[model samples]
Target chain A: MATVRIVITLKPGVLDAQGQAVHQGLRALGYETVSGVRVGKCIEITVPDQTARDDIDAMCERFLANPLIEEWRIERDQDRDGTGRSRVPVLPRSQGS
Target chain B: MMRFGIVIFPASNCDRDCVHVLRTVLGHDVEEVWHEAGSLDGVDAVVLPGGFAYGDYLRAGAVAARAPVMTAVRAFARAGGPVLGVCNGFQILLEAGLLPGAMLRNDVLRFRCTTVHVRVESTQTPFTRSLRDGQVLRMPIAHGEGNYFAPGAMLAAIEEAGQVVFRYCDAQGRVLPDANPNGSIRNVAGVCNPAGNVVGLMPHPERASEELLGSDDGRLLFESAVMWLETRKRSLVTPLRGSR
Candidate 1:
């Protein structure tokens, strides 16, 4: 099975209130070095290995993400070994970690 | 009496409130159209009431925008039928691409539930025909994602078309930052399509349809719709009279 991951984030210049709140919380916890934060969501779908990239792109454009205020990226995990190590982090890491 | 249809999605909670206002308060015929319905048969007007459809998954109104009924709703609007979307309904209209711009989380990062004054910006649409330009109406807004946003060029185009129907304003009818309940750009509270047939607004006019609800200003909108429809019917029947 091939797993396609769609990550959706607000477009630039759009405010991310939840991310701002998280950033404030981090600062309150003494992480003053955290300059910014933006929040987004990820959706993973399992399809046959022969699933075309266009189909996945259509899903993202039609329903998975809104193009007006958001941008999306897709990552494909074509093979899943028994070790289960193909998972990708949905959000980017902050400065320290 | 004109027939009004209120589309009810799975989580829609305000459908009955709209029914009450249209059927009971305004003495009009009302029908409840489920989201899955294939058509809007027999209804003269349409209303998309407020609620967290599909649990507001993905984003507010995202899932519901693709519902089957919207196809019919889109057709209805294209045919020049009046359609009003309130609160979450407004979000769905934006998602469905029937309206311009998108809704973002409130700038204050809070769900605001309060009465606000909105000045009528235009009476050219079916929804605001009974209201005079700059008339202020008190209505309650309850939502977290009511902030309206549009790209710079699109915002300018909307403004140039005079599509804005309502603007958050002070009691004295001044548009100011303090009057903006959700930080909607330009203090816009309601807007119509370019054709002025379909309208979407963040305020819950159904909840304030009577004086007992603290304001009957919302009733004017319903009255305006009815008046528009009546005039339209008369014009169709007497096109050569040239009396309109």
Candidate 2:
């Protein structure tokens, strides 16, 4: 089985109210060093075989995310082996930091 | 007689309310159209009432916007049929690309259900023809994702075209930050398409259509649509006053 991962997040300029609440909660818990937090959704889908990149892109663009306010990318575990894992770029640090 | 079609998607809570106001109270011919349907026959106007369609799975109105019925709605609007979307309906309109911009969670991250004062910014659209510019209407807004946002360029363009139909303002029509229930950019509460045939607002006009329920400012919207239809029928030529 091929496992596909889709990560969806709001665009940089769009406001993220839930993420901001999380940031505030972390600060209240004494995590002063953590300056920012932007929560996002990670969806996993298991397909019978390797899913085509075009299909995945369509899924993201059509149903997985709102193109107007969100950005999404897909990750595929093709080999099902640990070594073949794809790396994702980390979110940038908060402006205050 | 003017006929209005109300779309009823799964999990839609305000379909009945819209029907009650449009048919029972306002005495207009109304029909409930299912979301999966492909046609809107014999309808002069269309309404997408507020509700949590598809349980707001991906996003408010995101799933419903792709439903088959919206295809007909889009076509209807493209042909100059007046379309009004309220609350969740507004979100669906944005998702369907029938209108510009998007909706974000409320700035306070809470579900706000309250009567907000909205000032009509334009009387050009079929939906707002009954009200004068700068008229303040008391309407109830009940939603978590009512904060409206658009890119700077899009915002400026809509504002310049006078497509901004309504804005949250004080009793005296003062638009202040504190008066904004949601952090909608520039205190915008509603907007219309450039053609002035389609309008979407994050407030429930149906809920405020009767005085017993509170304010009847919303009734003017329905009356305006009916009047527009009647006027069109009499003239046989659309009396569209201005150009975008």
Candidate 3:
């Protein structure tokens, strides 16, 4: 099976009120170094290994995200072997770190 | 009397209010249509009322917009049937692509539930045909994500087409920054489709349609719609009779 991750974010000019509120909270917590913040969402779905890229793209365009105010990108991770060790970690650590 | 259909989603709270206003207050026939129903048969007009559908998961109106009944609603709208969506209903219309633009959280980051004045910018739509241009009406708006936003070119096109039906304004009908309650671009409180049959507004006109509820100014909108529908029916019949 292949896992598809879709990340959606508001367009550049659109206001991110929730993100701004979080930025303010970070500043209150002494994170003054933070310049700005923009919030977005990510959805992960598991589909059959034979699912075509075009089908996934269509799903994102039709229902996963709205094109008017938001933009979305898709990332696919295919599990080659029966073991899932090859799957990428949700949050991979920095290479140098 | 013209029959009105009010679509009731899983969490819709305003469907009954609309039915009461149309049936009891205005004395018109009303029907409550479930969201899953695929047919809007035998209704003169349709209304999508307000409330948190699908618990507003994913996004407000995002899930409900894909409900089964929307297909019928789209067909009805395409045929030039009148449709009015209020508050969350307005958000559904946007998400469903029945209307342009999307809503964002209020600039103040709070749910504003209060009364405000809006000026009728255009009287071409069925909902506002009886309202004079520039006439200010008092109504109550209750929502957190009522800020309207559209891309630059799309916004320009909407304005060029004169689709803006109502704009936030002060009591004297002056459009000013201070009068904008939700930070909507151009202070748009309500808008209609290019054909002027579908209208979506952030305000709760049903809540303000009675004097006991503080203002009866909203009643004019329903009255205007009835008058327009009646006139349209007459005109349709006149053409068939081969008379001017």
Candidate 4:
């Protein structure tokens, strides 16, 4: 099995009540048009190389993403060559590390 | 004047309580310093009281970190004044860069409150002078964000330097993981800056100062600061001109 790394994060510098905040002006205006406004989060994951993207998606929906509070995206990197042995994925597919 | 100032932002409900303990029990003159005002000119000590500052609107202390008063608080820390940030105040201190790392949500995802055990890990600073190394004290705590986290090396450095002032403990003061209230790393409940002049704790010591209210262990923290000040005051000032 091959190995890869996955990092899930709110979009860059997103207003993460957990990370950043809305520009003060955006909130004071009460743009009721804004409906519900909230920040997001960052989650990092590692997995086996051949693990289908669908399986990863399921993991996120079932556990990582709390539908009521957040939105997220995933990033990936392959263990290509050197030191790949040290970057094994806990998911069993990327076990070299 | 034996003046102490508390940094107050929008939702700091505990500022007055910290002051009450400071004024009534600790017997020191205290004031509520608004974060919008941003100055610690005459305060001998600075306290960051607990409560949901900025409604805990942004990551516990994140929003409050940018408040005007924090600027003064930061300067006060740089000048070596004794600073104590309790509960959310601790979170603010970290967010202001006076301390290290950030606080995260409870691992269990629930608001926790009640009496918890804490062990005095050090007595070197003004706050802990009343405590003995390894002594145990139970203090009441109420908060949603009490987990303390820091990088591995930073944690080790604080320990090696004797800056880790308080640790979560068992009833008898024995520190154990089971006593860890928020699933924090190493059961750490409090710590100080490298200079030892700044201390931050998650427990509400102010709540425990009166025997009628609960335990009296909280009084020591305030008393220790007074003792530290009395001893150091002579060194910092010369005899008054009229006294002679």
lDDT of 4 by residue, B28-134 (tens): 89988888885788888888999998887636777787787778888887877789999999988877778765575665555788899799987876788767888
User: Which residue pairs in candidate 2 collide?
Assistant: none
Question: What DockQ does model 4 achieve?
Answer: 0.03
lDDT of 2 by residue, A1-97 (tens): 8788888999897899989999999999999999788878988888767568888889888778888789997777853456655555457678973
For residue A80, what is the lDDT in candidate 4? Answer: 35
- Comparing 2 and 3 by DockQ, which wins? 3
Report the C-alpha displacement of residue A52, candidate 4, in angstroms. 36
The TM-score of candidate 3 is 0.92
Better of 2 and 4 by lDDT: 2
Number of the predicted model whose DockQ against the real structure is largest: 1
Model 2 lDDT tens row, B43-87: 999999999999998889999999999999999998888999999
**Winner on lDDT (1 vs 2):** 1
Better of 2 and 3 by lDDT: 2
Q: In model 4 chain B, where is the ten-residue run with the lowest total lDDT?
A: B235-244
In CAPRI terms, model 3 is classed as medium
Candidate 3 backbone collisions, by pair: none
Q: Candidate 3's error at B107, in angstroms?
A: 1.5
